[model samples]
Target: MNEDNAEQGVIRLLRAAAHTVGPGGRLPSVRTIMAELRVSPVTVQHAMRRLTAEGVIEVRASKGAFAATRRPTSEVPDLEWQSVALGAKPPGDESLRDLLTVPGPEMVPMSGGYLDPELQSVAALGAALGRAARRPEAWARGPVEGREELRAWFARQAGGAFRAGDMVVCPGGQAALSTAFRALTEPGDPVLVEAPTYLGAIATARSAGLRVVPVPADADGVRPDLLNAAFARTGAKVFYCQPLYANPHGAVLSRERRPEVLAVLAKHGAFLIEDDFARDLVIDGTPPPPLAADDIHGHVIYLRSLTKSAAPGLRVAAIGARGAAGARLRSARVMDDFFVAGPLQLAALEISVIASMAASPHLAAAGAEGPPRRAAHGVGGQTPPTPARHDPVGRHAGVGPPAGRRRRRRTDGSRRGPRRGRLRRPALVRGRPAGPAPAPDVRRRAARGVDRRRAPAGRRGRGRGDTSRIVNLRPTFPVVIPAHR
Candidate 1:
């Protein structure tokens, strides 16, 4: 009803074009138009909503918006349709420029509000298309809880300890994560983050009406004493971690310190949310257990995404939760999207999942002597399917494990580690000594783990393909497993 001339002018003309040229006239994409008009997506979305309601243009599900036919029109444009269509000019790089008319050097193109294009993938497009094709209904309005089957799949894939009932799906990690923060704390609440942590988490916290406490971590791991002291000082309720292959530096947490960090959380009576992106991609040693495995009390909450390994476009992430935590997240998701989503780009997911699968072998290889840590909970003994681990741990006596990983024993008795979890290097066996440890302490030389029993004769986990020194990071939060049946 607030349709002033300024608001209606362009919409009226655009609607007229849609009426005459047919819905296939290909109106300017939201991106192209936004850049050209310097309008926000919300503005465009609002206008488009009106157009769709009026039946002037039919918004295609999953695909681009289309002009709906059956509107009364006096005249329809003929030749050079686009030039005269929408009363707008064509854009460059129709693919990308649609988002921005080529941002100036200082502008730093930012659409989707958050997320960097640097990490976006083209494969996501193909995946979404494929999904839309198979599940034609994917383009239609959907359930508030998401496809129950998909949600069930997510629950099933949660680290071994969880159940299908404990899972809830969300549009993205940001939503799931923000919901968690909002549920757990009040405004100005104290929370933990790795120093030089994922900036997005920092931004996410601030935007969600909360406060944060950043913990400093070295190559070995976060300083437990510092964490304990910080908790004593701030008395925070929640702790955030990207333990396994944390974003940015990709540092793996050392085993020696995993328990120490967990102890700090336990002492503080705080909850943990583990993010297992890199850990999921392990191709080398068996995957490690999640920090939630150590949970005797209901304090750990696991949140993972199909996005990192599957495809960001999937906008599909799952919450592996326990007790009241999972329920809180589910409620938040409902409030946010009411379980309703647009024609999902299910196609984009396959690309990431496939890529993640391909990298799995290398991820395992890159880990330490032991297999990757298992999530405290698992899905029918599956290694909690995921992607993104890299190859290397050093001589291979001992290096710190990857980010936030906990510790474990390897098949050949070598060290396997993850966020908040890790293991000691396999000691000598029999009369032989494996070569020096693979990795060195951050302050020392690379001294990796050695297995006199498993080492090739007197040779330790040395040479290529040796994970003797590699360590995987654990996600920042604690994940939990539940009973599905």
Candidate 2:
């Protein structure tokens, strides 16, 4: 085709897309455009580039292209990444680790949690590999809502002993979370949250352009009345909390308070985002039923993570969404990616099944079955803290208890500067009140919360990928824990 014809064809596609978008209320994929425009791959690319650049559409990583990003859209375009192709440039000096890495930062890498797949049980993974290869049928693009087997297993696990029919597999806890945020809040809307809930969820809310209003919490989790007050004060639409083994605090919401919390959520028409993260490793108490357990109104969007339980490599999480919530959550996933990874999801399904059997009384304890030997290195700190499930970088970016229980914060919207005395990156924020406040004491850095993790170098390969992380995993997820309220 001539260049002029190409341009005309491109214009034709754009107008068609605009019309299609007007009626369909969503952007069609490149494939649909090809079938519709009856053009080649290059033609669709040319047209999409024009649309995305013109602010008429957006090509969101992982979520695919959507309508132009507007207010309450996303936290920062820098963070919402999909696949990091090998050739894909590293965050171009803005790498995730860049924000965390400190200058002269030669400490014993004990700053955070890391889930190296090499540290996982290879024998079980090998069996899973065989299962997948034998059934290549598992390789097709699986449901964007996640495979039914995984959802059924998740449903069985949600709410302690709830039926499997209640659960739906979300691509990952993050995807499930973003969906929950959309389902519960509106653009430019304010919502209540645990002072320090999952950071990824916070980013997701901001991406949707939801105004965040953090509520206060202690070691036992958020105070119910305080939460209620935040709801009333902010006229918030949703209540986001990590009820069990919460992300940074590593504390479970007290069982006695779970019902009251849910009641408050229901009373307010606010859906409770009980990020039942870290369920597999409750360290101290008997796992309580999730807040979704007795959800009288379909108000709880309970999220479960597998990164901690089976393996982070699975990149799988599920949600036990009730009523119309399930349908909405599915919509968010579809708008992002038509389908979740097929083989990995199938593998996740099988592993989830294994986790259920292993955790059950009928089967021996998963941990007791065989603990992988840790490499003996002269480590300085106490036992490395178990990684929390949510992304720490996301958490570190915003530190401070939700609203009423506010802690001191640096001018920039970042975490309360690294323990008591870690190196503080005071530069990278929204803005700073200009003034030479005081010559800060450089030698005053000391550890605040004692939870430290150090995954030293020299690791073997994992079955999932040909990579080795020098640190620990992203708070390795708890296997199959029930999602019943």
Candidate 1 shows a clash count of 121
TM-scores of all predicted structures:
0.49, 0.55
Candidate 1, RMSD to the unseen true structure: 19.4
lDDT for every model? Answer: 0.50, 0.52
- Stretches of model 1 off by over 4 angstroms after superposition: 1-128, 133-143, 280-287, 340-485
Lowest-lDDT window of 10 residues in candidate 2?
Answer: 437-446
User: Model 2, 116: alpha-carbon shift in Å?
Assistant: 6.2
lDDT of 1 by residue, 1-485 (tens): 23354346457656766866775676767886567666666667788888888777777776777777564577985767666676843221121222213332222221112122322344455645666667757667666556666666555454465765676667777677877887777777777776534445656676666666777655554568877887899888787876654543344666777788778878888887776555444423444466666556667777767654433456767666777877777777777767635455244333434335444432233233223321211111232211222222210111222344433222222212211123232211110101121222111111134321132222333322222231211211111111011
Model 2 misplaced regions, further than 4 Å = 1-119, 160-166, 352-485
Q: Tell me how far the alpha carbon of residue 432 in candidate 1 is from the true structure, in angstroms, after superposition.
A: 50
